[model samples]
Target chain A: MADMRTPLSRARGLGSAKKGTEHFWMQRVTALANIPLMMFLVGALVVHAGSDYTTMTGFLGNPFIGVVMLLLIFSACYHMRLGLQVVIEDYIHGEATKLLALIANQFFTLTIAVACALAVAKLVIG
Target chain B: MSEQSKPARPLSPHIQIYRWTLTMMLSILHRATGVALYAGTALLAWWLLAAASGPDAYALVQEVSSAWYGRLVLFGYTWGLFHHMMGGIRHFIWDTGRGFDLKHVEIIARITAFLPPVMTLGVWLAAYIYPGAL
Candidate 1:
């Protein structure tokens, strides 16, 4: 098996697109970040539940909460993008279709991140 | 040049052959939960936009989200978040190339499946039991 050689293999770049390890690493990194962020988010929501919009806004307006939320938004968007990219790659067979879906995933995730950031800013600065 | 005809080789060990194990079920559920979370992100955006637009817009969002349909969707989102969170942790374990053994794999899968719903139910229960606590 070690001695067997194919000329095409030497010419071909990294096999399997060389993407698996990066995805695996990013997923773990996000997972670690989410451990604290998720706990904070759930606690924040529970604490603010049943409050009016003003109250909720005020809670989020706190600098500490605002920063934690920024972390959460960034990590969640990154993780979501990675997860959906794989899903699109697996399910969408056509190269053009897959590219479109991947683009859509990035667009949507970025939109969510920006929207969440603006909302946080409104609460904090406004 | 003559092209030699060769008999087709059978594919080995496909998804259909196995008695589905816990890890297999969890693997598929992770993807399903991921898709669910993707939809939930849209709802989060809607909530944020509503919050940013001030009282009138926020009120409208509140009205829609406070209704029965809204609660149902929130419940689904809550469960999706929990399930996906646990599934992510499982993936983290696998990322290190650990926990591939049969017993640990099944244990983690079972925990992932059961833990999220329990946590969601607990949170919802607290919401109902002590409505003003938050």
Candidate 2:
């Protein structure tokens, strides 16, 4: 058996899974995606910051804005999950607690993302 | 598997006496900013749900978000968002294995550290004065 990989490479937790660059790649992808999406979102937020009910719903209810919001929610939540996963792995020493926290982190992120998506969908379609 | 009562491995670098550098400070801030954004998303959810719910709810959220305390939080959120983004960019550059030189790294670190507040202020100003220009 010729295992040629360096100990340093192996120790780095390459992929944190089976040759898995998924987490690292996804984090960067979402980070890149967030740049432009945040611009769009910040613009929308500024316009709607102090706006009234009609103004708020009216802008958000637009099909374009609704789609963008959905995209942003998805990307941001995934990024948040990945980021928190790193934090959890680094700091949480107890195996059980780390596992629980990682699971909870995804669930929490999904709940927020879903809630936001539902709100946007309702505004858009209704 | 039997666990040893007195286990192995001592963690090093002696954290208490560690000298903080700009890059190190920004590295920690990135995670802090990330957690802040996680909490801040609650406000976004509230606003959207309020809009979906009705005018009353919408107005209520708006009232709170426009209040001084609300504005302060919003401003901090804005800064956190931008700063984390800058930190992300810096890391991305490093991930690509470019700009590891001390001078370049410090320059990027300084920019990431200092620019967010200014950007946040500029954003809010543009938000108020120009009112749709950004």
Candidate 3:
């Protein structure tokens, strides 16, 4: 290929977005956080699997459990967004479709995070 | 004119063209399980919403989840959770700058494949043994 850039243009490197590694780093961080958070969730669920409504709400309504549940909700949703972005980028080829999917991924994860957090807060605070 | 100067080249071989390895299978499984777990969040959200919405909603969720199909789905979720957890641990091992050797990779992959089922069974058994103990 023929060189098209001026010497000054070549000298100036492609600008660092400065946030290039944020997605990767956050994914790993959330994945690490999820280990304990999700295990707590699974353990809680298994123990309360057949419980009545009172038992279920009572367990989840406790302050500590509520906090942990909120953490899990946010972390998992964020991690889900990052993971799905990779999948969408890999498989969705159409430019408009890919852009729409990426936007939808963000919105969906945010909605889940908010809904779960709000539900937990309502239970815990009431 | 510039396009004419370039030589026509063969495309690279895709996944189907190569012999599949345990590592390859596990790698894909990791992503597949991740996606499954992502969908499983809907169940989580439903549970939370039901619990917050009061007894009727909660009972409805309970009713659905108690059915055979619900158990089946929950069982799958249980397995997927452990499977994805094991896959994450494997990646963690690699991230720490080790476990790249073919033998070690395959060995870890093999363990990841079987351990999730055993763990899932153990958990279910424990849950059955001590029902609703939270």
lDDT of 3 by residue, B1-134 (tens): 34566458866888999899888898898999999998888888898998999999998898888888998999999999999999999989999999999889889999999999998998888777774442
The ten-residue window of minimal lDDT in model 3 chain B covers: B1-10
Please give the fraction of native interface contacts (Cα pairs under 8 Å between A and B) kept by each candidate: 0.63, 0.61, 0.67
Candidate 1: the clashing residue pairs are none
What is the Å distance of residue B99 in model 2 from its true position? 0.6
Chain B TM-scores, listed for every candidate in order, come to: 0.82, 0.86, 0.89
Q: Could you tell me the fnat of model 2?
A: 0.61
Candidates 1 and 2 compared: the better one by TM-score is 2
lDDT of 2 at B113: 88
Span of ten consecutive residues with least summed lDDT in model 1 chain B: B1-10
Show pairs that collide, candidate 2. Answer: A15-A20
Q: Put down candidate 1 lDDT per residue, B12-128, tens digits, no spaces.
A: 776999998777888788889889887787777777778777889888878887799998988888888888889888877887899989898888888998999999998777766
Rate residue A54 of model 1 by lDDT: 83
lDDT of 2: 0.86
The fnat score for candidate 1 comes to 0.63
